[model samples]
Target: MVRTMNKCDETTVLNAIATCRFASASDAELLDAWTRDQLAEAFATLVNRYSVMVLSVCRRKCRCVSDAEDAYQTTFLLLAKNSAKIRHADRLAGWLHRVAQRSAVATLNRTAHMSEPDESLGEMVVIDNPLDEIAARHEAIILDEELAAMPERYRAVLVMQVYQGDPIETMAERFQTTVGTIRGRLQRGKKMLADRLRRRGVVPLIAISASMTTQVSSVEAASAASQLLGMLESSSIPPSPPLSESLLNPLLVNGRNLMSPWNLGCGAAIAGAIGVLLMGPAEGLVGASGGDTVDVVMAQKADADSEAAAVQFPAVKPADLSSVKTKQGSVAKVEKVDDPEVSELAIRLKGELDRVSDVSIDGTVESLADELQQQLGLPVLLDKRALAFAKLSPEQMLNFDSSQEPLRTSLRKLLDPLGMKATIENEGIVITANPSQLVHLGIGTDRWLSVDDETMRLFTEKLSESLKLQFIESPLRQVVSQLHESLGVNLMIDHRALDDIGVDDDFPVNYSLGGEVAAYDAIQMTLRSYDLELTVRNNVLLVTTMEGAEESLLSRIYWLEGLALDGNFDSLTQLIQTTIKPDQWEALGGRGTIGIGPGERPSIIVNQTYDIHRQIESLIDTLRSNSFHPQSKDTGAHKSTPARFGNPASGFGGGFGGGFGGAGGFMN
Candidate 1:
């Protein structure tokens, strides 16, 4: 009877393993001699134990419910395939997590088609006996209340630890942060949880026992663990969180679709003008080929070179002696001997000439023509033989054409040069001229006067000082102010644009609040000011300001627009009204001043696209300023995925170049 009981227990354990594959090293040796049917039974045991956890991981990381389901199945499939290579059962949970994570990321990169968070969950389902289920259901309500109320960072740490049961090391690894940081997060998370429970009139059990390495020891943490188990165990757990939304759903949609509300609205209209005629499913809108556009613009400029000869000046005419003003104060004949294109006859008068100060001297037709030809160094044929008999050349016979008055007027200036007698005091007054020579200097012509080397050096110093003063009165101050406001977060704003010259970094602006605050705090304050609350997690920013504040998701949308277009308040408002779902508006702080709902979260997820959109919009603005049209989809080709052993990971989309992953630093 004892032997039979032992056999029964063994059989039960083996049956569980077949269902879940949750077996340790001891089971490995037994499985070595087991048939295929026995191995399958062992795998099943492991599955039954951890399937719930695996599904949760999949939902958290994947694009859609279907995707998550697929991922869960795939993980099991992989386990079955690699049964022979099984090593330790204790690591199975971690291995399963890795598999799911990879699957989620892979699916997102390949086809990012996740729906928005389920709206159905927002409306409470009617239960037949509400009072009977109230006790068990109340816990879920409390948990939700606590979670929704907690700071985003703390909540994130709690979720990862409690619901996911992820090891501290794994959390640290996932966030690409240190164990110390994870510990810090866990400690703070525990305190916040305790505080929240106290607020609910529940005396929270909270303690931190010392552990050897990076490990958290809290009674509340343990309680949280038990609550999680309870929630998972009961499929009908009241107020179960809507299925986890996609990680990539906040950025890209399936194919060329951009997940942002504003993108959907405007992207449709500007498809053609932005270079892509249509934004079809597979063939998303693409701008005019960049290479072709560049070539066409260059070719247009190159075509103008053929017209240069038409503008070339005719051969210089000899001075007509008949018009020479011989009564001169000084005949200071200046000569340029290099090419001798034309000879200057500077016959300065005693004072400024009466009507037309400059004059051209007419000489003997023949000798003048010869001198003109010799000076031009080009052969010219003269029409007059009498002029030729005096050794005249063809170049000298070239006369100014007055067919076009403007051309005639401009050409006449070459023959009739300005003349003046040198005064004793003005012996070396440098000639004033305007040339494109100073373009090589960094200053642009629009904002700066291009001067010669001597003038530029002197002007740069003076201009630099003037700019310093002007910067103080400039709108750049407002830009910086708006930047802080638009980010909805506190930043170490580097006010060094004119700091060294005009304002120091410490010099407070009108809106400056003396000291810095955490970005989360600042974001919270900003959202509250707009009657909203922001919630942040792993780069996801959720606006959970109120029940009515769900409408403020519209404002959050405005924040996105503001961020994209450098705080254009008008655009921000318009985008909000256009992009947000009507129901979500109530969840965001709606149209009031600093409204707060029960358990409002200040900031939840950190939206990375806020930065990306800002950059793209900045680029668009720059392109417009430079008179170059920008394409709509600035995102490059290639999607983001993990690296395989044989093939390096490659981006596979038409957007930001970087792949999807942790920030790989504390800063993320």
Candidate 2:
């Protein structure tokens, strides 16, 4: 006999099912009633009958409670949207189960990188039958695999019928066919899906019954059904324009409303009044017109002068125009005002610095700069006196392999040989002879090399290549200085912060580098013991203390449960203390804390950088994995001690003891 359970009066439910003729009705009959007639009661009955099984499958496949709920909602929403396409009502349960699992897996994959567990959705009821749960989960997996392997059209039809709950008539309209054609497609789709599953050494079946009862609240099921129905109704309406694109288009600003005629008329009236006031009376216009014209001309010139003064070029130095002379022996006019065309050209060139090109420089700096200017569509300024002094020969060719390098890097390589540098200053890239002067001019220092994460990783890998080097407790400061000198890169250290951390500049560090050990590895090994690390910030090598580095790191909280600690809070607290170490925990200045309750589970709170937190999390996982199980025979004696308050051994229900209790106490 077909039976169903609801979280309402059993008698009432049976009576309602019998009165509605749903007691012996197949899934297809209910689906047809709901889809064709918009029967809300029929839809509610279907949701109540299947939500438990769908949620059970979702919880088994999902990693978190929120994901399970999300999958559950998505499964029903899909069904509601495509209620008309279901041909085989008997297979609806199996189809929904598979879809729920797929949705859950997708959600888990999307949130895999998120550290903190989601607590937004209500908790799922724990399943008691482990074997049954495993079987259901396995069946769902087989269905998912088979569904994935099906042809696109077959899968779409199957999803519409089973997952989306689309009526056959609606789907026929959607696919531009008759209801019989849609039904044929559904039958073929299900058969193909089953065949694929059988080929994979498994047979798909509706092992879990839709009639199986669950403790899931009827109110929740009814609510979900109502929402699904609303969604179905809303989906029939035409979609509005995208907010982002609509806002960007000036003519379509604020969705269909532009500058109204009223606004335009008001603006015109205001303009007319302002003109009348400015021109004075019309009777005196001829006499005062000439003076007014002169006044307007003077006003425009003053406004132009003010605008020019406001355009300040911080990178350009205030040098005499006579100092710069062209090859023709005449002083070149340097406009004090900012040139809009030159500014626009410079912006474009800066954006295209990563463009690949083949450049062959076979002449003097003057000729090379001129060629680059014409090729790149930007001005390339070179000091005339400096270029003349170098006196480059035509045969002194510099062929740049820019295919693998950016334009900026190639330009730097070309200029460095002449004891000069090419810097992107305001309106142009200026070639300066004095490297130090470039810094003062605010050109070189402001344009640090921008490296992506992948490039930096490769750089570190290269630096880690094995090198033979040895240092016997050498002062870290001296070692860093030597390494920086060898690498020809700037290394900065916070000497004051180091002193505060009790690390002197002359503090000794030991390292022995040989074989394939890279210089980068050696440096890291030396700093490892001193609680120091190397970080690249703003394109500069920074050597700082671990504590100092934590300032820039993100803070996260983690919850751990089912630790099987036998309610022994003292042992748990001691274990955590030993794992993290008292000195290290204290050094965090209350940023990290552990809380043990009078239960098996405990919580750990850590405030550190993401990298450091990952290390701590790994340690905790190891401890949890190695923890003694309460169910084991050897732990029977420990389990007998009833959980109570104020027990020193239990570490709860009374006064605080040692370890975490003495440090920060248990967190509720």
Candidate 3:
């Protein structure tokens, strides 16, 4: 017996609903009128009733007003599209709340930029206190754990009351139970949640009331609702009729007059227009004279379709250099670049250094350098002053077999006391008088350099492949020295500090690692006996006492903008762990974690060195660059999932340390 509004305008209809007491109509009644009678007023009434609630959810989840508004529109649009699927009208509010949350999450995932649209729109400033941030994270984790541990039936009722703001009557009807039963379930759910939270040392009790409330005005809601309804009505395409209607007249197509040729042509034209709109503007839609040409337009459209069909999708494939071979009748000679050959030689030298070999040499530093130069076919420069300063006997016998240990380890054992270190240079391997001098020659920042996960993995693999080790009670210095030589990594040992701790070069280290264990792991095993640890400082490895290393473990926070929006948290975390040193992460333990903030920006929390933090930031930058193009090819095989790292051609050389030469050193 309700009267419909005569006027189609939003203000008039809203005024009519208010005056006629239609504003207070139940959602079930409004939905019935809209679905059964196709009454525009009924649809408008539903929108007005729930728009404020939807807006509140959006505002709470979104970073800015603009994003919230987009989410708001999307939520209601989805509700309208799926109206027929609503089986329980009384639970409509709860359903809408879920939809609003999903809409906001989807919106956040789609947009990378998360800045406040306008400060005047009441954007909340996030506090940047470390203690507060940690507390909030712990509270959220504890709450989730407690809720998940609760019984299903009790949990459901509690969620309905607290999160969805459903009345007790609505809950009873939804569960098909008595009011007393619903109240009992709510009470039990609350008590169980409180007990769990208390045991976990979180809050003593859970809040039963809804945390979020609608701050939007009735007038604003009415205006937004009216606009949404107008969009739906003016779509120029009607909603599909019920299955019953279609079944009754299977041959009769709705929205067109099949008997009239003109009506049929108009329908076809409308369909074509919709296709064009969905696909974006077509080429040659309008002629140069600002008029339409049917034949030319159709030809262009046909061409576009053909081109789209002909385009081939990129596939993961391996590089095929064999295809460069000439046909039987042709003769072609491939020319190699001298620079590339030199670079290849350097790579080979590193491989050679990794191989386990016996070294039984009784010679001076100069003689050792000369022998290495001749064997490796590369220049080996020894500092004369460094040798003189060491005051070693001219026939000092340094006899040891690498026995699968890294060449660097053997070299370090030979040269450590001489106040000299060997590093790869553009010219050749230079046995320099000062280790600090070599740092100056490296590329990028001396303090910190970026190394990707893939590069780190490849570096470790290469090191493992080159090394062949079997050690049973080897000197600690010799073990570390061999590891350093094969890896070409700078290992700075604090001898003075080690002496104070009653540990020295002859400290016995025992390991049974055979085959190709990772050089990093081998080094760690050797250091474990002395209670020593390794930390990276400006790309140099510092093998020092654990106490000294602990001083560098400082907590830092970094804002990883756009990472959460990309929706690749798992991939990103994996990439980080793979790229960074395993020992460094282990040292951080539970302190190292990444989380998506309320505003959708990802934040990294870790206790690490400043250099390590810089490296992480670099890796994050690389991830952001590859965010848009997620998939990558490898060895002709199509990746089942997007690559954790981008194209190898993008460059992933260099170790966790800085570049050694112009060549992308182990982690560059």
Error of 3 at 612 (Å): 49
> Which candidate would rank higher by TM-score, 1 or 2?
1
The window of 10 residues in a row where model 3 has the poorest summed lDDT is: 293-302
lDDT agreement with native, every candidate: 0.31, 0.45, 0.46
Q: Cα miss at 633, model 1 (Å)?
A: 20
lDDT of 2 by residue, 1-668 (tens): 96665433443454246436663455666777877887755665667666655665565556655566667777676566555555544445555654555566567666245445544222333457766545555665555545533434455567555544668776665554445445645654665565556655665554212112222345555454444444444555312321222222332222121232233344455444323223323221212223311000000012311211111122223362123333324333332334542344333334344345555565555567777776555577765554433343433555544444556556656764554545443446655443222212222111112334344444444555655667787887888787777555667776654654555667666777555465666667777555566655554566766544544343333323223333343444444433342223322122344442233213334444433544555554554444332211112222234444223233211111111111000010
- Candidate with the larger lDDT of 1 and 3: 3
User: What is the full ranking by lDDT, best candidate first?
Assistant: 3, 2, 1
Model 2 poorest 10 in a row by lDDT: 292-301
Give the residue spans of candidate 1 off by over 4 A. 1-49, 54-75, 78-159, 165-170, 173-177, 183-614, 617-668
Question: Model 1, poorest ten-residue lDDT window?
Answer: 293-302
User: What is the C-alpha lDDT profile of model 3 across 1-668, one tens digit per residue?
Assistant: 98665434745466356435665466677677767777767776667666766765666556667777777777676556556666655446655655565555556675366775544234222436655533553454344334433434555566567554679887776665446446655654565566556666666342222123123455655566666666667765333321222221221223111122222234455444323223322221112223221110000012211210101112212341111222222222212223322343333344334334444455555587777666445567665554443344546655444444445556655554453455543345656442212212221111211333334334435445545666677876787787667777566776654654555667566676656665656666656544566764444566765544544454444443322223333444544544464323442221244432221112345566534555675665554443321111111111111233332111111111111111111101
State the lDDT of candidate 1 residue by residue for 1-668, as single tens digits: 44555533454454444544433323333334332554434444455445655554554455455565556665555554444454533234444544545455555665445676443222123345656233333443344345434434455566556555668777655554445445655664565566556656644432111000112123322322233333333433223222232432232121121223334455444433333212212211222232221100000011221100001112122342223222333222221222222112211110111112222224443343343334322222223432222233434433332322221122223222211001100111111111111111211112111113333233223222311111123243353354445454332322322222232333322223345554434444443332233422222234332322222222111001001121122332333333333112222212221121111001111111122222233333332333221111111111111222112112111011111110000000
| Ranking 2 against 3 by TM-score, winner | 3
* Model 3 spans > 4 angstroms off: 1-9, 12-29, 111-117, 120-177, 188-223, 236-668
RMSD of 3: 25.5
Model 3 residue 221 distance off true place after TM-score fit, in angstroms = 3.9
Q: What total of clashing residue pairs does each candidate reach?
A: 66, 22, 21
